[model samples]
Target: MILEPFPPALPYDFVFKLARDSHDLEGYHKLRREIFCEEQHVFETDDRDLFDESAMPIVCKSLIAGMEDTVVGVVRIDERSSGLWYGSRLGVSSGFRRLRHISPGVAVRNLQPCYAALGALGAGLIYKAVSTACALGCHEFLATVQQQNARFFQRLHWQPLENIMLHGLPHVLMRADLNHYAAAKKVA
Candidate 1:
């Protein structure tokens, strides 16, 4: 009889933090390219833009045995003006997006249950970005969310400002209610 090795357990918990080093930054960029370029075809090669120069990259890292494992989610936040901030390039690894089960009561109208799991992860990344911006003196935070995910953002305390076209796709301009997110502790 032949014996097969067991698969490694998937990570259940994740760490949300600012990409602070080369490893984290590399992971951040790699995942963004995978999602935005390869998966969504939003960009032919790279998805980086001028905003990357001043944008702060935030990562959601999966934890394996209490240690950081991989960058499973990513978002970048930047101050566009004196008190206006924006979050962009939000994504989660396709594999990891299915790692969690949707809670009994959580549901998004007209969307699949799987999205609830995605929203859970997205919420963490959004919170980190919003709080970090708040800590940096941001009075307003905004994002251009995909049309399909507009309702999810609305659930997260973001208000739809207007509809816009971006990256050859339909998107909604949304703003986060600063009152919902408290400023995060200062990051080094």
Candidate 2:
């Protein structure tokens, strides 16, 4: 059987920074609407909720020369209580959904192994949010993942604590294994 070759090691520079200004915040929301409301139809019109008021948004932008620093992916995190944090609204722009296919540039050659394994834009965004939670001293990180994507979270070292329903849809309550996500510390 012919084994598939490795993805090309090309330049993949993108800024995975927290939304600090209105522009960043707007971009984050726009990406979320595009993914959830339009693409996934998870929301009727807008996905903004009470959590958005307190959540800290993180965005991934293209770092390629001559290209705008477009928000390619976004995820938000919020502390629900003492030592507990939750990540939500993890989404990537439709056009950039192929983040897994993009290899890192030479500058990121020393990135952690987890980045290599979870190489997609959406995964990277989640890693960033989780890292931020860890840096903020969260004892446990949680998220309600869509049922279909539960296995994807498992691959990223998240354990399903329970199966539940949210907004009339099946979902899984998951917790991140800090050990498997240690790489997030470096970027946090």
Candidate 3:
């Protein structure tokens, strides 16, 4: 079913579920490599971490066309003792890239606008997950975002609770109050 992919434009149909076991791991890794490594100037190293094995992946299909449909977006959530959280490589594919303010003549930036739309998508999904986590007795939603991406979370009122420097790259430990997430859901 379509759950509002974006404000006025819906690019993909939302699928709130887990990644396929083992068999689909390669897809997730390749996506992370393309969006984070190839598209962005981020590190080319494999983005996998300990949580990858446990994190369940989520996909977005074209709402107009429908999984024979293209997989335009992907994300995975992993729980750390602190609270249930998800992170590491969430991005929109190049094909469905929206052309707007970021669709500058520059080839590389053409897709940034499409990815910008993902903020709305991620917020919708993650907040729902946070609500579920709260029901499961989680107190907060935790995530480690690349320091360069802190602005995205900040748009949703998330705060950087910790500063981390690892492997010569800056990262931030961000926390979202699930209490607020639940309250928002209740209001909705």
RMSD (CA, angstroms), candidate 3: 10.2
User: Which one wins on TM-score?
Assistant: 1
Tens-place lDDT digits, model 1, residues 61-91: 8766667789989999999999999999999
In terms of lDDT, which candidate is stronger, 2 or 3? 2
Question: Residue by residue across 148-169, what tens digits does model 2's lDDT show?
Answer: 8899889888999999999888
Model 1: worst 10 consecutive residues (lDDT sum) = 105-114
lDDT of each: 0.82, 0.78, 0.55
Candidate 3, superposed: residue stretches over 4 Å from native: 1-13, 21-26, 41-45, 66-68, 82-86, 94-118, 183-188
lDDT for model 2: 0.78
Q: What count of clashes does model 3 give?
A: 1
Q: List the residue pairs that clash in candidate 1.
A: none
Judged by lDDT relative to the true structure, which candidate is superior, 1 or 2? Answer: 1
Please write out the lDDT profile of model 3 over residues 64-108, one tens digit for every residue: 443333455566666677655555465656654442332222112
Question: What TM-scores do the predictions have?
Answer: 0.86, 0.83, 0.63
Clashing pairs in 3: 19-57
